[model samples]
Target: MIEENRFPVIETDRLNLRQVTKDDAESILAYLSDQDVMKHYGLEPFDSIDDALDEIAWYQAIFEKKTGIRWGITLKEQGRIIGSCGFLNIVSEHRRSEIGFELSKEYWGNGMASEALESVITYGFEQLNLQRVQALIEPPNISSQRLVERKGFIREGLLRNYEFTCGKFDDLLMYSLLKQDYEKMSYST
Candidate 1:
């Protein structure tokens, strides 16, 4: 189980999904500043490391408010922060949250995202007592869509022109996973 309720450090074979700190700003800026990394990220890429520092403040504020938590993904062997993943929104009364993630370009296609996600998702369901988790992905991000689906999220529907990002309106595909669904998946194994 989780010792610290909010923003618990999660460990896996290749990664550690740990609490985000101001010290990680430089590491996070590497990806957040990359256009390719932020292509479908629903926001403009960070132009400076200060932007990442601001994001670190945002992450800490959200956790302090109990509204959301973002974990910095640490590649243990490499000893550097490679990415981030966590609940983008937490609707406490509804017992659900919106999940989001981003990984450095160098780490893409290596299954590291899945490893970090699995740890956080498990923490959400088992420790946070969340009943459902939802993910919103831009239509063009096939890899992200596949990542969530492989973890048992079912495609709910399409939200046409749901957001304005990167200077244009974009459509998003919605996907969700129920706690019961995850439970079934665990028991089956």
Candidate 2:
């Protein structure tokens, strides 16, 4: 079990990362239900508002368990939920995990995702003391690939037929960054 103190609220210049709540259902539905956002994510668009509500409930349960950390990303200025970001598929024994994120289309191309990811990566390394973090990008997600690369995650290689999305198997590009590498880069900067 993760210690409660281990997970603290994190904020970046333009974003606030906090625990998700049932009240976030509408905001979650705003982005999650968009077909554009769901295209490369390997999941169907939310069928109804109830689906988003159920997801928020699941997120709340996970939060209480202290196993996986998820956050609802809100714009600092507007105080609106633009998307979600967090550590998914956590494996404590390995001191490693996969990071995932999604933002509303309106917020894309504005560097919000990159900024949020940088903050999360720093948190994973500095606060969580994790050894490594990984991200799997779908083949066609060039924007996401660039975002991870800018954050110092190296593209390891491709995992062919790695995920089933939109009724077909999709290739995924694996990327990872190590705590040691992050430390070195930060020290240099």
Q: Identify the leading candidate in terms of TM-score.
A: 1
RMSD of each: 2.3, 2.2
- Give the Å shift of residue 68 in candidate 1: 0.6
Q: Roughly what TM-score does model 1 have, to 2 decimal places?
A: 0.93
Displacement of residue 87 (Cα, Å) in model 1 is: 0.4
Residue 99 in model 2: shift from native, Å? 0.3
**C-alpha local distance difference test of each model:** 0.86, 0.81
lDDT tens digits, residues 1-189, model 2? 256644467888888988777778889898999999987778899988898988788677666665567788998877678888878766778888788899999989898888788788887777667888999999789888988887888999999999877788899999999988787665222
**lDDT of candidate 1 over 8-78, digit per residue (tens):** 77888888788878778889898899999998887799989899999999889878778788889998876
Q: Any runs in candidate 2 off by more than 4 Å, and if so which?
A: 5-7, 186-189
> Which pairs clash inside model 1?
none
Candidate 1 off by > 4 Å = 1-6, 186-189
